[model samples]
Target: MPNARSVVVFDAFGTLFDVHSAVARNAASIGPASVHLSEIWRAKQLEYTWTLSLMGRYEPFWRLTERALDQALARSPEVDPVVRDTLLTSYRALDAYPEVPGTLARLKARGARTAILSNGDEAMLADAVASAGIGGAFDAVLSVDRVRVFKTDPRTYALVEQEFGCGREDVLFVSSNRWDVAGAVAFGFEAAWVNRAGVPDEYADLAAAMVVGTLDAIR
Candidate 1:
């Protein structure tokens, strides 16, 4: 959004990484019901974060993700501990979107410092980055675990400033999540909504400076 060079801070889950693949990775165990399980698990996982944020009773994303899986699995005909464990282990590495690798490379070629601000635990993020083969592409990976809270919170945004030594205007925050984009905009960062699904921005008034269909439009 900023014409001048700026730091790029990305949201990890739905933005940089493909969360749906988290369950899909366990397809061998989940079988034909994988899509339903993924949808339930992902939805509840986010809902739990918001619930925790509102209640001020924060749990690590890993625990919350597992809880979401449990809730989704409870509706199934039978439960397999091995299957659940396999799904939980799958979280350690999920696939990145198709365009992500090249997008980051281009952002770096033009001299922008990049970092990932995620709800994921450190090990979760580490494994994801490593699995994606893009660990070297990031300047840093920040986690809400430090503050023990979830995102769309001002404190989560502040972690970027605290770690990167930059001001809101000098940073371009990007996320596929409208709430996250709104939170960064509310915190004064120039933001771009990577509207991957082509969904309308509910907070159009608060608004990202640019709303692109993919990260390819970022530069």
Candidate 2:
């Protein structure tokens, strides 16, 4: 069970925010390829992070996001160049999940320290948070940019302890991404896998403390 002193850290993209909404918003311009484009863009974005990490190289997540978009667009040449610009702009202000504000409010009401720990760069996180109008909901919005690396990295997870001065056990790390939950579990933090899509599970050896279909089910 969580307590007032427990820090409830959340993954921003896909967890609290809807990363695919950018493409959804531009569906009229993207035609039948919108879903595929969004899927490829996200997969490549994550791939770049892991690949760059292993190569001991670093780039801002925003750059990787744009590059991923380029690849997605390359496979979708039917989309106008103007639409690509619009999609990129839309991504910076992706919509928050409907339950996010309420869930964060409920957690804060109980005196839990809430925060967003994301692989996004600081500016990207800032734009998304502000656009969602949930800027005041978090005690902090931590970005992997500080360490110049991405998730599944020990240093990336260490930001939580460094910010809250709490032990791993006292933190409940929540992410919609199963791999991220696995990484948190491996780092010794109690984690919740927000399996929002009801997808099949992986990383069976790194089980989450809890698995829920939505953020509201966390408590």
Enumerate clash totals for all models, in the order shown: 0, 0
Q: Put down candidate 2 lDDT per residue, 1-219, tens digits, no spaces.
A: 444337999999999999999999989877888899999999999999999988989899999999999988887787765777898899999999889889988998888998899999999999999999999999999999999889999999999999988898889999999999999999999898999788998999999878898989765
Predicted model with the maximum lDDT: 2
lDDT of 1 at 161: 94
Q: Per-candidate TM vs. native?
A: 0.92, 0.97
- Tens digit of per-residue lDDT, candidate 1, span 140-192: 89999999889888899999999989887789888998989998999989888
Highest TM-score scorer: 2
Model 2 bad stretches (over 4 Å): 1-5
In terms of lDDT, model 2 sits at 0.91
| TM-score computed on alpha carbons, candidate 2 | 0.97
Can you tell me which runs of candidate 1 are displaced by over 4 Å? 1-5, 78-82
lDDT of 2 at 131: 97
Output the lDDT of residue 157, model 2: 96
